[model samples]
Every structure is written in C-alpha cells, then in structure tokens.
Target: MPTTRDYEYLLECANVIGVDYNEAENRVKVFVSQKMPPETLADEDDVKKRVQETDADVTVDVVDAGYDDERAGYEPLSTLEVIPEALEGRGERHRPVPAGVSEINAISTAGTGGPYPARVTADATDEASGAVWSDAVGADDLVRLSNNHVYARSNEADLGEPILQPSPQDGGESDDEVGALVGYVPIDDGVRVDVAARSVDRDRESDRYLELEDEWPTGVRRDGYEELREETVTKTGRTTGVTSATVEATSASVNVDFGEGGTITLRDQLITGYMSEPGDSGSAVFLEDGELVGLLFAGSTEQTICNRIANVEADLGVEILTEEPDDGNGDGGGDREPPVYTTTFERALEVDLEGASLDLESVTFGGRPQPGATVPLRIAVVASEPGSYWVDVDGDRERFEIGGESSDDLGHTVTASAAVPEDAAGTLSVSIAGGRLE
Candidate 1:
C-alpha cells in the first residue's frame, strides 16, 4: 500500500525515464542503462549491490565468439531493462470482523432531493470505514450499497451489519456557496467514507446555465444492474457554502476544442453525486461494488462534473485500481514482460557504371538492440545493369569485393560500423542505398 506521496514520486520517476503505466501489469517499467561487465564482487549480494550502485548507462552481456582468447572479453551490451516502480510498500493489513454493527445518524440537505443517511456502528471496522445503512444485500465476502451512494465493507463480509452514510452537509451551515468536503478510508483499521452531491447555476452573464453531462460511470457490478449507464440528467449545486440555496439545470453536450484545433464532444451527465469542492477534484467515483467509475474533475454551481473512467483509461492508458486479490498473503502474484517499442531503417540503391563498376545496393537495420550498444552494420549490394564492378565499404566494413562480377546482377556484403550514442540510447537504426554500374 504505497502512500499518495510514494505514488507521486513513482509517477515523477516514470516521466523522467519515459515509461508509462502498463495497465496489464499494474506497474511501471522503464529502460535504464548499466555499466558493462558490472563491478566484480564477492557474491550474488555484492553483485546486486554493485548493479544498483552503477550509473544507468552501461550493460553486461554474455556472448560466445568461438575464439579461444582470454583477454578478448565480450563487449558490454545493454540487454536488461529494470522495473523500479513495481517495488511499492505494502501497508498494514486487517481482517474483517463479524456482527454488532448498527447505524447512528441520517440527514438530508435543505435544497437537495434525497434524505441521505449517516450511520455509526458498534463494530470498529464499520465505524472506521463509514457504511451507509441500507437494505441492499451483497456477496459472501462483500457489502453492497444501492445506486452510487458512498459506503464501506469489512475485509470479512459475513458480518451483515449496517451503518449511516456520512453527509456532505455534516458540518455547520456554510454561508459561502463554494466549498468541498473531505473524507478518508483507513489503510489499516481506519474508517473510510464516501460522499456525493450535485449543484447547478448560470454562467457569468446569467444568460445561460450549465448542467451535468451523461456518460459511462466507473466500477464493475455483480448485481443485475449495469454500473455506469449512459444516461442524461440534471444536477443541483450550491454556488456558496452549505448556507447557499440549490441551483439546478439541464446538462449540455458541447464540443470542447483543445490542442491544435482538435475537438472532443463531451456528453456531460447530470448524475447524482458531488463533483465539485476545493479538494474533491481528484476524488474517485465508484460503483456500489467498489469498481472505479469516474473521477471528480470539474463543475460549476449549475452542475457537478466528472470525467468518465473509460475515457480516462483510454486517454491515460492507465487503470486507477485493480481488483483486490483473494489471497490473504497480500501478494498480488503476476509478473509480466516489459513493453518494447521499435524503429526501423531501410533503403534501395541505384548505380550506373561504364564497363565494370561496383555500386552500393541497399541496407536494412533492426534488432532487440539495447541502449548504448554499438551495432555492426550488415550491407548487401546487387548489380542490376549487367557489368563487372568492384565494391568498396567506407567505414569498418566487414565484407569487400573479392572477385569480378559474373552476371548482370552481383551480390556483395559488409558489416555496419555505426555506434549507438549515449543520449539516443534505446534502439539504433541504419540504412544504406546505392547501386553500381559498369
């Protein structure tokens, strides 16, 4: 259980290393360099320590050159990619308790429609993680809440108990129309509560009003109900504090123009939930089963707004939370290979010579090449116009023309001498294009 601070740090590291979150593995993997032949040490532990200490640039490689030479050590190569983001701290663990839970309080906002309920419980876990009292039933190990209301469940679900849901308006009346409510869920035995609200109001000139947009909600579902249905609706919001009145209006569908004339049509929803508050911007909106639905992004007095989870996932290529594993061991066991992106270089050649002439044909480059690895080039030449020609390679060429051309088309070969620079580390590309004529 990494803290928010830890998560932020990991994100920053990923950005620096140019690695994005891999939703499949729920981890981040980045390509880093290591010095060649890693520092020699006493044991495996020493090797691990040296590997960590070495600057990320050089790499160790094991290769067979067939030659019987001791001094000719294999060149250091970049072959390994490290995954540092996967190492997150697992927080305190707790099991669910059964029985002796009850609701304590319930309240409704003056301008809002529903009679929202709040509950306290005899059970410590229930008390810690706010569970709204409801007739809703859940699976053997989970608690269920109706609609998208905020609620909590014990690690052990057989405890069939109910508690009041916390109210957004729990504190004293607020005169200011704009404000946010904060709640927490304990990573250990602490209490967790979910809150929601809606609001509506006019634009600056009072000429038009804004409303909630309809879109897919977040979270998976077990009950017959489909979570996050696509539907249109209205919303109510308080322009000021809790003391303010409710403002309601219809949500609008508009195309928001963004970077470089690109436009995205946002189908806002008028869903019943809080989407605005000073600090609620990143709060997650989840379905009853605790599946993520959306993120509270923005809103005005006229509408509580949120970005759909599907859209967020599609855009960021990351998942907010994954399904909790059933194993009590606390280890989410699943390892994955890192993702690899590649680039290629290819070209054709054309050459004309009087009688016997050599011309460069074409070059193609590719490999699972690692950063800072010097790649040997492979070159091939073909004589198209029919003539005898001699071919010559400019750099540390591997192959050269040994005899005269036999047919109109002759083939020749050479090795690449290009070296991958440190900065442009990942992969290397080489292309050669030319032909010979005689």
Candidate 2:
C-alpha cells in the first residue's frame, strides 16, 4: 500500500528509478534500462531490494532504453524536404503491427484505397505522410483536412495536387490518387483554422463518422469549444493509431520547434497528456460518443497540442457533420457552466530559477490517520535555499524548519517527519505552498 510519496521516492532510487505511476494498477512500474547491456541491467533481486526501501509494490519492466534516453528531445534529420513542421523522428516503437506496414482494405487504420476517417495517406511533390481527414465544406465539397506540412508540403503545394490515402511511404503509388488539394488555412501563433484535401473521385465515398475510437461517443455531440476545460479526449492517427488523454490546459501560450532550427510561438492552444507520437499529426481528436474536439498537429514525449474543431471548421469554411450538431437556435439541451477558475500557483511551479529554489515533492502520513490518532508523517523537499516548511491536510497545518547550516547542501534534500493532528479524517484536501519564485 504505497502512497504517492513512496512513488516519488522510487523514481530517485537506482535500479527502480525509471518508472511512472500506473493509475490502473495502483503501483509504480520499474523499467529496467536496456541501454546498458542486458547482463548489466538491474536484475529482479536488486530492483526488489530498492523497491523494499519504500515499501512499495513495484513491477519491474525491462526495456531497451533508460527513461532519460527514452525521452530524448526529438530532432528530425537534416534536408528540408523530408522533415515536417514541428515533427521529429521517434526513437523506436513497439506497435501491434509495424505501423504503415499493413494496409487494411478499409480506411480504419493504416489503410488505403478509399477516403476513410481513421487513417489515410496524402501526397505532394512525390513525398507523403499520414493525413487525418477532417469533414467537408460547402454544398458537396467533400474536403479532408490535414496539416499544410503533411498535405501541402509545408505550404509549398499547388492547388488541386493529388493527395493519396495511405501516403506513398505506406505503399500508396502514383495510381492511388484519392483526393486533390482544395483548401488550406494559414498557421498563425501555432494554430490554424481549416485546411482541406478533397476527394477527386465523387464516387469514392468516405465516411462522415470517425473510423476509430468507436467506444467513445460515436459522433460529434456539438461544437466543443465551451467543453474545453478538463475534457477527456481520444484520437486516431496513422502512426500511433488510437489513444486517450485528459486535456491539461484549454488556453496556453508556448513556443514549438518545427525542425531545421525553425521555432514559432503559439498562443490560445489546448494542451493534453503526451498521447501522441511523431507521425500522429492530422489525427482527429474527439470526445467519447464521437464529437470532434481538436485536430492533432503537434506533440512530444510529455504533451500533445491540438486545434479546436470549431476553429478548424471556421477556418476551412467547412462544416463537420456530427451525429448531433448543436441546435442553432438554442444552447443545446443540457448544459451546466462550471465556476470560473483561479490560478492555484501560476508563477510558483516554475522549473529551476537562476538563483535559489524550493520544490515540495511529497507529504504522506504513516498510514490512514484516524481521528485522535496522531501519526508520523514524511515530507520530501528538494531545495537550493533552506527554510521553515509547512504542510496542510484538510486545513490542519504544521511546520518543520531546519535552523542554522545543519541541513545545508546544494543537493539538499532531507526526509523529515511531521504529525497528522488528531481529528483529521475522511478524504482530506492537501496542499503545500512556500518559497519565492525567481
């Protein structure tokens, strides 16, 4: 029964350092690095001893690389034609089947032959990458949407150029013409409205509903702009196929690297768990029940970025044909606006200031604290400047300040104990705030 504190502690220990919380398993997964020779990797016995240090039930998973090596910054190879905007080559992946290798007859995933919503190929200048299809535009304008980089060759493509499904890289040959470039929205501030790749063959019917993540809402419920905050999301792309995540930020401003030393600052964007890989761009993100939410354009090892679907439709002048479009005359049927939010710690969560620091990692009680049962509590802190520290559980607070140079060190981290005051019971609200931001 390890607590979150014990989980953090395991990450700092050797042999069991490369791990992440498995919320489903309720345990930490220890990844044995294979970067070292197999014989040199941490053995089960050694890892178990380290796991015992924190009294955590840890699962050791041996992998070919260490955590640091696994998350290395992605940088695509040189040569401007091949690299895409804001994308990089992946380290290596273990997919069910080699992605882009097996093309099913249907456009469900890694497939070609027809315009399908799940996975399709696109081409320009004799080069290709996977393009996620967006909806249509105008009366009969069946437009499929994708990045200007993937479909338009980074904005250098001519109007009506052939865009292949299951891009040539995945075996789409010159004869595999599915659609021609019809529309493109400009990318500004790392966000773009609508961009199109339309079907050249009117008989080559494509599905209006998404071909992947059928378990989620099977159709677009409504324009999801108002539902952006903390929304649960899922997506299907060519490379990574289908994956799920929670939206971390509805509005964010940040810079994105587009390879070849080109980087641009994007604002008013959505951020989510790093559920995407390199070639997942153009994957359509949706709410369960299948309402379009965002378009997957950029991502990394730790986070993914998307454009709002409403923005996509607006910019492209296209209309998404969801099973349930919002009623134009009213605010739909059922709606409840959550309270406006306040920043809990805006400037406080900064990573490594130029000068001093105070990073509160964890605070945990020995066990479930009972009313009138005071127990030993542990506090884990990483600091550049030492000072008095405080912990709060359900509004009950306590402090532990190390005086003098007694606990001073640059790598200064001390495991200190506090007390869970009597009367602390039930589910508790816990928080810790201290240290100045540089």
lDDT accuracy of residue 22 in candidate 2: 38
Worst 10 residues of 1 by lDDT: 90-99
The deviation in Å at residue 56 for candidate 1 is: 67
Provide the RMSD of all predictions against the true structure, rounded to 1 decimal.
32.6, 30.0
Per-residue CA lDDT of candidate 1, range 1-438, in tens?
211122112212111111112222333222111122434323342322333343233232222222233211111000002111110110000001000111111222111111111111223123333432223311111211111121121121112222231122322122112112111121121111112221111010000011211121223222321223333222222221111112121122222222121322233222232233322222334443334344332332223444444433322222222322234222322321111111112111222322334444334332334457654444544444444334333322233333444543245555455556667643444433333322
Candidate 1 global TM-score: 0.20
Q: What is the TM-score of each candidate against the true structure?
A: 0.20, 0.43
* Model 1 stretches astray by more than 4 angstroms: 1-275, 323-438
- Residue-level error in angstroms, candidate 2, position 118: 15
lDDT, model 2, position 270: 60
lDDT of 2 by residue, 1-438 (tens): 443334434333333323334333554443332235445545443544565565545554432222354321221111123422222111111011111211211121222121122212122211121223233422333345665545554445566667554455455544444566655654444444323445433222223222353233345433535356567887765555567898755544334445533544444446677676655666667776666677766654556776676565554544544221123221222221111011112321222222235555334344454555554444444565556554343345555554447665322233333344465554333344444332
